[model samples]
Target chain A: MAANNEFVGGKVMTTLYQHGTLALLVPGLFTGTQTVGELLKHGDTGIGTLEGLDGELIIMDGIVYQVNAMGQVRVVNADETVPFANVHKAHPQPKIAVEDASSDALKQIALKELKTENLFAAIRVDGEFSQMHTRAVLPQTKPYPTLAATAEGQHEFNATNIKGTIIGYFSPVIYAGAVAAGFHLHFLSEDHVMGGHILDFDLAKGNLQIETFDNFNLHLPVHDPDFLETKINAKQAMRDIAKAEN
Target chain B: MAANNEFVGGKVMTTLYQHGTLALLVPGLFTGTQTVGELLKHGDTGIGTLEGLDGELIIMDGIVYQVNAMGQVRVVNADETVPFANVHKAHPQPKIAVEDASSDALKQIALKELKTENLFAAIRVDGEFSQMHTRAVLPQTKPYPTLAATAEGQHEFNATNIKGTIIGYFSPVIYAGAVAAGFHLHFLSEDHVMGGHILDFDLAKGNLQIETFDNFNLHLPVHDPDFLETKINAKQAMRDIAKAEN
Candidate 1:
């Protein structure tokens, strides 16, 4: 199995490609510099947000989709820019049936099934959801406020008896500032009518697929003065991220 | 200046390629899987150690050199394995001159000159040192001890009026567990006769060259059981790293 993919010492080495830090996003460094076109070059599946906290983004099957504050889903333009994202090449992994599980239960399942508690893993869940609760922030103009502030004004969307896919990445506690520690997930309904940053969900029945990542390619925004000039306090930023993301 | 290298929004982005995490090292996970030949494919210059924490490694001008526990420097073979390393392609950058400066003084100059307090940067210093203090650990067998314990048995070497180069990296506080926060440097004499992990140094005169990195490619060893099964405690590992490296 290791020899099937890119191998290093006969071990499959899958990379989780990340753009911009969650710490940068907490302080509202929302200027989009990397285009959706450029991001696809690295990997095909992931999640993130557009510039100015425009919407919740889902990259599936090499296509970019955005779920806006008004609960409208649209196929994002190739030239559209993204402020932050986590993408990776998808591969076949063992699957497990998850029934009547909450968000926390899903995390526990990941920990037990994947054995990636200390390492990074990319997770995907596909099936029917009894309840899905999500939110998306309205696009902001120049001089954006902190993400926590933006999240407070975010619009919530709820759906019941819906079929969709959940995409997210699991980061270890040590990488809290660079990426959100633990499961950070986003949802996209099957019909492309409902999707956003997932706040909570009750999985009625879903097949959980997970791939462990051995490499992390962290790309920073060095050109943006806002990124370089801002004094990012890791501890404070982690707190802000927890508030906003949760 | 940004246009001279790979540009994203008019900013030059150089990358630092790292194999294995410092946290893995503190716990004494010292099985070398990545070969030196394979590592050089990512960058030309860097610092790290051989398998089993055998010695201090200094990579310069695309050559891999290892300073043994007895302070003997020798060119490493292409197939020699590396347990941990940090490497990047050398690029031209503005230079600064330092005379009569300590290790702390060198760090201050880097912070002032590079303006990379929140970002990662690669630093190099070449010149004569009035005094140099360094150490290297002997090779360990199976069931290696913790790095802090190994540091106790490390062989320390000191020299005066020597010409050498300092190679190191500056990682932000947020990345303390992944990489050591602040400056982590290693020394190699101009004659390639005396070099090791730097404990302290007094520079008589040296020209400093610094390059800011916008990307960090961290590769982990997935096949090694020590890497996969070990439960790494970030906080404890950090304390141990400080004791060993300092």
Candidate 2:
């Protein structure tokens, strides 16, 4: 059943479809078994990392894009693979106008207005940002390093006075290891030239759309041998991966 | 998509469909929002608890049965609601012959033979048992007490030289709060005369069938105001509810 099906009465349910776990990636299990094309079938809006943990992934309007470590943006091929991702079918929700909201401010607004503390919330913001901080990791070769180590060499940049859409998900603390515990957001500019894993941002003025999901579909990888053999220490990974706090 | 759809090749995917979270029940929220009829639509077999913490629920062969505090067996009404449940469509798997195995041994075999430590595992055993220990709680009226407090008054019994089926699920440690971290099982007699939440068992020889799932569907209830307002402390519940450990 879709996300809305979890509730009674006539309502549009949106399932938060996720492929792979952040825990697997923490231990350097970067090889992907699910392709981009297959992931798009589950949702139109989402965020994740590409195969090899090459770059940040942004899915908007059913199109997949990759933001490289050098802050380069490119449309990823449909056949390209992904190591981890979270996606959902976007249903139209009433947009609330937000002014000069910080990252934490947005979280508070969602909790106070949408009442999404216990549930998973899908958020989208379309407007100009006063400042945006983001980072992306380089593609690794065979014998991939742990995500924490990979993140150490990430390319961080600042984009000011830019128009973009914020795509993100808020996971409950219970899913800390399986996914990032809190807000994990990514940004994509209108020009499709700037986008990456968002570190921080100041929304000048934006129309914030929030959708709460009552269902979560965690799709794990079966083909990857590392995923099977690895004793995932996600709690350890969560402690080590500081960037996961985004 | 079905559980098998998560994998690339043609392997029957078994999706572990769960309604409500173990965390929600921690704070004494025993109101059933999802009906038994609604739960069975997602899967044919499962285990759960009834509203008001009435009894242990066992779903086998598409039939729902409740074992009360007195260890009495009765068919649950289709409209009867459950506070928590885990179910999956059973795709026939090669059964492994297990002989004179304890509860821990069954887990070991599942790990060695089925390799289910990292994945969600659905296990079923049909055979005779030398010793079977189980417990069930009485139905609580409104103004329900917390699960830990209700578990204190549980009725425990021992059944020796009995034939029954063990229905259970193994959740990874990452899901400790949402579901039991380890094996959570329920037992039902072949004659449908005896059944309850399993504490321990000694199987003489049985056909142990295990289905590993790559997908986990966590369906949350939206109608329950308690679920929305309550700050669920599942970690606290996990520490207090000793019966959660099988």
Candidate 3:
């Protein structure tokens, strides 16, 4: 299924040397019935020798050494196993946080714009909105209100469509589940920053999409406070640096 | 990393269905805010609704539907999820009595041949090894044994390297451990049969290598067993059936 050696069927058996050095052994070969003496003569050049038992051993090139009877050999370079204490250990700091506009700041901006307009509509960062963290602009046409009002009215609004852009940054994370989680962004500019909770993840693509929720029929404006601030600050910093260099 | 999707610098979201169904939806363009009611009046049909509580309805084209707060939509057709149950629950048959050829039977055959020669081998018919089940003949090499002692002073009896061919049938099984254990056969004539236990099986390539303790070396004969057996047995059966018909 996945292009990994574990799932596909190919394993290498290796001998762990006492010096913390390891050797790459032949893949899928076994040391059967042969004694320690006999195994030594099988052309192994490694410093280790087979223990006196019926267990398995790894014979890479010519060197032969004992392995756990039950263990299967992995086909990787000798140095690969050095960092792995065991094959199953989890990685530390497995996720990287990507910067994004704050949700609260975006809501504040949206609420301010609504108040200025004297509109009574409620505003929220709708997680249910598909464009919440994407470059995709909200669709021009609205179907929900039409469906709510009448079946015939729904059809008319579908003719002309509205579109807006959602923009944000993405963070990366390690996947421990059978089904991988999609990528999400850290709201770096938000007053109440949310971190480490999975949002808008995709397993297959192994990426995250981040954007503002300014599009669609919602009452929010195209400008998000944090995003606007980041853009302005970036532009100002670039100008100041250029003047200093001059 | 596996080159399945195009690389994008944003958050990635993917939806996977039970039976190999996958969909990728991304945010695009939104021009201005329109109520769900206003957008639905356009009479377009690209809109879809998700099923759940707090479901916010989405309008695409002329259609309107709700998306639950969870940001998940189950768009799978009814027929798709059925085959997943069958594939997940399947289990192969286990080994049983007829499948069990005792170690004693192998020992008896080995002992009988060892009386005349230093080593003896036999391949038996059962399980996956039966000709009725698998017709594929695996490539096998002869065991290279080291010289132990001299037969006579003048003439040295060198340790012979013997490789065998597919003559009859034999089913191999793992006895003490997860490793495979069994013997392969090389036919000599109509009455004489020889084989040995296989020490290595390559599941990926379907190749088998057997290690026999005897000195006799054999290869597969030119005579086809199926043709010969059919000619001999079909004659008698055909005659009996003819008489019954008469």
Best model number under DockQ: 2
| lDDT tens digits, residue span A116-222, model 2 | 46788888999999998998889987798988788888898798999999999888776677788778889999898888988888899999898888789898897
Between candidates 1 and 2, the one scoring higher on lDDT is 1
**Model 1 C-alpha lDDT per residue in residues A1-246, reported as the tens digit of each score:** 112126645755688989888888887899996889988877889999999989999989999999999999999998989889989888877878999998889889988886655678889999999999999989988889988889888999999999999998888767778888889899999999999999999999999999988788888877788888887787789799888888
Model 3 error, position B21 (Å): 19
State the lDDT of candidate 3 residue by residue for B52-155, as single tens digits: 11122222223333222222222222221110000011112221223222333433443343232111122222222211111111111122111111001111
Worst 10 residues of 1 chain B by lDDT: B1-10
lDDT tens digits by residue: candidate 1, B1-246 = 112125546755687888988888887898997999988887888999999998999999999899999999999999999889999988877778899999888889888886757778988999999999999889888898888888888999999999999998888877777888888889999999999999999999999999888788787787787787788786788788777777
Q: How close is every model to the real structure, measured as TM-score?
A: 0.92, 0.95, 0.14
Each prediction's DockQ?
0.39, 0.47, 0.01
lDDT of 1 at B21: 84
lDDT of 3 at A184: 16
lDDT of prediction 2: 0.83
The per-model lDDT (C-alpha) reads 0.86, 0.83, 0.19
Candidate 1, superposed: residue stretches over 4 Å from native? A1-12, B1-13
Comparison by TM-score, 2 against 3, better one: 2
Each candidate's clash count: 0, 4, 76
